[model samples]
Structures are given as C-alpha cells and as structure tokens.
Target: MAGLEVPTWDPQTAMLIGAILFEAIILYVGYGGLEKLVGPRLMELLVGGESGVSQ
Candidate 1:
C-alpha cells in the first residue's frame, strides 16, 4: 500500500505568502480608512447635496 506524503514547509514560500497577506490587509485597511474619510463627500458631490433618503 502507498502512503500519503506530507507537504514540507518552505521558508521562501511562507515569506512570500505572508507578504501577500500583509499587503492585502494593508490595502483593505487603507481603503477602508480612505473611504471613511472621503466617501460621504464624494457621495454628496455626485448626488448633489446630501447622501441619504430625503423627506
């Protein structure tokens, strides 16, 4: 019977994956903060005064 082989951990691959994950997190947080800072103003500009329901 053949046994299943376990995958080995490669430091370089791990580092690359970590870097990608870090960048993704940074972009997410950065964009979220930027949205918070500019989203309302942008919406108002596009909608022409006020961003929500009117009445």
Candidate 2:
C-alpha cells in the first residue's frame, strides 16, 4: 500500500475514544432515566384499559 498514510495513536486518539465512551455512558444513563420517568405512562398507553388479562 504505497502512498497510503498510516494513522498512529496519540493523545488525540485517546481523547477521541474517551469522548466516545463518555457519550455512550451519558446516553445510557439518559435513556434509563427517561424510561424510569415515562415507563408507566408508556405502559398505560400501550396496554390500554385492559388492566389485567393478557392474550
């Protein structure tokens, strides 16, 4: 692979990976919090007035 530039690891790569991991963790936490906040309402909406009997 002539003329192809090979990338090297540096502080920038570390920061990039750290940023990605931080974002993933933040996203997971945010979604969990949102589900906790909205789960009941969503269940009611999806389940309707059926209340108990399952199909």
Candidate 3:
C-alpha cells in the first residue's frame, strides 16, 4: 500500500482566488460609495418630499 500524498500549492489558483476576492472587496466599497452618493437623490425624486413623512 502507498502512503497518502501531500497537497501541492498551486500559485495560479491562489492568484485567481486572491484576484476574485480583491475584486469583490472593491465592488463592495464602490457600491457603498455609489449608494451614499445617489441613494438620497433617487429617493427624493421618487418620493417627492422635503420631509420624511407628512405627519
């Protein structure tokens, strides 16, 4: 019987995973920034209000 083999470190796979993670982080931050910049304006346009509620 043969012994168990060790797993090899794959540089390409590591880089690909790292790049995907980095892109996800960037997209998250960018979306948050975009939401902060445009969310209020969009809400105001859609709701048409100087105040939060009419009450």
Candidate 4:
C-alpha cells in the first residue's frame, strides 16, 4: 500500500481562485452601488403619480 501524502500547492490554481474571489467582491460592491443609484429613480418611475393622492 502507498503511504498517505499531503496535497501540493499549485500557483496557477491559487491565481485562478484569487481572480475569481476578486471578481466576486468587485461585482458585489458594484451591484450594491448601482442599486443604490438607480433604486430611487426606478421607484419614482413606478410610483411617481400617487404622491399627492389621498389614501
């Protein structure tokens, strides 16, 4: 039987993982910013005319 061995580290795999993580972080931040910037405008467009109306 073969002896157990520890897994080896690979630079390419590390870089790819790092890139994916970076991209995810960037997308999360960008999406949050975009939502904040556009949310009010979209809400206004959808519900703008009812502001002065009585319940």
Candidate 5:
C-alpha cells in the first residue's frame, strides 16, 4: 500500500487563492461605501430623528 504524498506548490492554486482574496477586498470596500452613503438615513428613520445632544 502507498502512503499519501505531500502536494507540490502549484501556480494555479496560488492564483485561485489570490482571486478569492481580491474579491473579498472588493466586497468589503463596496459594502463600506454603501454603509457610508445610507447608514445615517437608515439610523434616523429607525430612531425617529436626531438625538438631542449637539454634535
């Protein structure tokens, strides 16, 4: 019976990992921008207008 051998480094695997990482970064930035654009409006709608404390 043959034992399992360790896999060699492969460029294709590296590229796949890099693609996933790149996509994750893009999604993070997109969501951050969307949050910045809509977050205050959404908070005001939920809380029924601004707080009494001055900014």
Candidate 6:
C-alpha cells in the first residue's frame, strides 16, 4: 500500500464536469420528450374532466 494524495485541477476535471453536464442534459431532454409524449394524457387523467375555475 501507498499514501494517497488529493487530486489537483486539470483538463480531466473539465472533461469529467462536461461529461456529467452532458449526462444531465441528455436526461433532461429524455424526460422532456417523455413528458411531451405523455403529458397530455397525464393531464387528462388528472384534471381534464374538471374545470379549475367557475365562471
């Protein structure tokens, strides 16, 4: 075994952050797509039949 050392800042850090950011973006896009695909159906199921405000 050997002594461990703290990591210093470098291009790898940027790449790691970028990868995480990209993953987050992909997840956001995927969820957004799914929402668009199913959001109406969900809304209809949850609140479509009811009027939110009475005139």
- Tell me the deviation in Å of residue 6 in model 4: 3.9
- Give candidate 3 regions above 4 Å deviation: 1-6, 50-54
RMSD each, Å = 2.4, 4.0, 3.9, 4.7, 4.9, 6.0
lDDT of 3 by residue, 3-54 (tens): 7877787999989999999999999999999999998888888887754476
Clashing residue pairs in all predictions, respectively, total: 0, 0, 0, 0, 0, 0
Candidate 5 displacement at residue 2 in angstroms: 18
Whole-model lDDT, model 4: 0.85
Give me the runs in candidate 6 sitting further than 4 Å from their true place.
Answer: 1-9, 49-55
> Against the true structure, candidate 1 has what lDDT?
0.90
lDDT of 6 at 19: 100
Q: What's the candidate order when arranged by decreasing TM-score?
A: 1, 3, 5, 2, 4, 6
Pairs clashing in candidate 3? none
* Candidate 2 Cα RMSD after full superposition onto the native fold (Å): 4.0
By summed lDDT, which 10 consecutive residues of candidate 5 come out lowest? 46-55
For residues 1-55, what per-residue lDDT tens digits would candidate 4 score against the true structure?
A: 3678777879999899999999999999999999999977787787775353447
TM-score for candidate 4, residues paired by index = 0.70
Candidate 6 residue-wise lDDT, 1-55, digit = tens:
3568776779989899999999999999999999999887787787764443335
lDDT of 1 at 6: 75
Model 5, 1-55: lDDT tens digits are 3668776879999899999999999999999999999988887887756653445
Tens-digit per-residue lDDT, 1-55, candidate 1: 3668777989999999999999999999999999999999998887777756676
Top candidate (TM-score): 1
For model 1, where is the 10-residue window of minimal lDDT? Answer: 46-55
What's the lDDT for all of these models?
Answer: 0.90, 0.86, 0.88, 0.85, 0.86, 0.84
lDDT of 3 at 2: 67
| Alpha-carbon shift of residue 30 in model 5 (angstroms) | 0.4
